[model samples]
Target: MTGLIETNETEAEAARKAEADAAARKRVADARKDADELAARIKVDGPRIVGELLSLARECAKQSLIAKALNAELPEGETPVPQADIVARDFGAEPRKDIRSRDVELWVVADDGRIVGDQAAVTSSDGITGHLHVAGAGLRWRCARRKFREVEFNPRTFTDWPGSFHELIRLPRLDGPGALFDGSLLTIEAAAALDVAASVKPTKRQPRPVQIELIPVDPTWPPATAAAPTEADANS
Candidate 1:
């Protein structure tokens, strides 16, 4: 009967609509899941982001006349000898060495509403979440100076994996007082934290795996210049 046929067609159309709705919901859920994994990866390797800031500062100092002037003013980390008004004899003397610093820290802020200090996660390990909450939180470093920089953690997190950056930066020094990608005499601790982050394998977790090796890039500066500034008088 015609009535029976109409009912069957209506049922078929309803089924198709249901399937399409389900697919759309699935896609949205998947996108949200991807965003979440990305956020976790960023949280783990955030330290390197701080290191990059330090590197940029070093590059700035290396290229600026102000830096050379400051270097001259500060001198090497060696002790300074007191210039005696009258010398007992015209003999030569060794200058005292200035104290050298191989340790420092800095700050890192995630942009684009990508990450927040919010959303604490409970790890599989017991109270591991609390440990992370304490250790992982805050700016990794407080400050950095000279071509010297330092990174926390016993082993290089980025080089080791499961802890590294998911973002690359081509940000200029103008972005912040200390924002560049190169520094002369950068310490290995910070180097591993920065460049190493973008080269490690993903943690590959369920639901969504953490993907790293994504970094901010500035191709303008050659690789050689990446570790330091380029100028006629780079040391200055």
Candidate 2:
């Protein structure tokens, strides 16, 4: 009877251990399943979420800059120009007749109301038209100018570009150049691009900058020589 009781106790303990082990294995499997599902969801939604966040951030920055520009004090000779006026003058049914010569200086306003590129030429064929010919040697100006050319030449490539009123109202930066306001002018193509950018609402589509690929310089005089065959290549 004592032996039988001991045998029964041992069997009960073994059963409890088996139950615990089975529960632990089930818990691990459930955890792994959850982890896999989470990874799959992230793989599908991660890019979209990141894109939306970036768009939101850009819109916020653009609005903040615009507010700063609107509240900024003007320089002695400078006057504040409305964004609508600029658009009207450039895209109106009738062309402006009171075009100014290139000799006139129209400075680009920074977000902080500081003037940049004071020497930039403001020219117009029609008296009411204005064009800011940015000639600053600075890297920022160079990039801005290059981008303008790219958009002007290839407007179709960047149909979804974001344009802000502040960018046009102020000095155009490569990363954030906005609309062209009155009193200053951009090329018609540039202005059109800005108009497209401004009119479109922010969406999941990310605006990509025009990429200009550099052509490799062709070898002059002598062409590149081929590498000599190795011993292994000769054996093959």
Candidate 3:
């Protein structure tokens, strides 16, 4: 009777050990599957994730700069004043998709109440080709002509090729033009004319375009005076 009891106890111990081993093997296989799935996801989405993070950082830096400028211009004991009333509009399609094949018209205005006429500044979404035609009399037209001439008709200062990854165009500031023009209008024009092309080749997956907000900087905030350039000065 004692021998038989020992044999049964040993058999039971072996069964428990086998069950544990089988569970361990299953757990290992499941872990490996999960790891492989994660690796595949990262491989597919890594570039887009990195691009989004970079864009977020760029936007944050821009906001920080704007805040610093506002703080610096505020009076010592005065509350900060809002410069412009921002109006948000919702376009169903993404800006890149909407603006990609379209030409944009901008109404550039000056503080002196001068406006760019119907033959306004028109630019392609890509910023590669555009015409700056400001019709009307006075300092605004002259300033625009001079600036365009200086840049040889191309306002695009910097661009990342193979696609519109990033671009910078130098436009005359309100203060630079003797405060005759509104800085807000220039900002709007720049925002509208910005390039959004991601690639030259047609791909099913288009890269996300950079988003630009129309934030007007107050030309009067810092309080600097610039005399309007004379005809001779403009010509020279």
> Highest TM-score, which number?
2
RMSD for each of the candidates: 33.7, 29.9, 38.4
Candidate closer to the true structure by lDDT (higher is better), 1 or 2: 2
RMSD of 3: 38.4
TM-score of each: 0.28, 0.32, 0.31
Candidates in descending lDDT order = 2, 1, 3
For each candidate in the order shown, give its overall lDDT on alpha carbons: 0.44, 0.47, 0.43
Q: In candidate 3, list every pair of residues with a backbone clash.
A: 110-181, 110-182
lDDT of 2 by residue, 116-216 (tens): 44433544455333345444643232111111111112122312223443233432212223522331344333433343344333334468778989775
Q: Per-residue lDDT for 152 in model 2?
A: 19
Output the lDDT of residue 103, model 2: 34
Weakest ten-residue segment in model 3 by summed lDDT: 143-152
**Best-to-worst ranking by TM-score:** 2, 3, 1
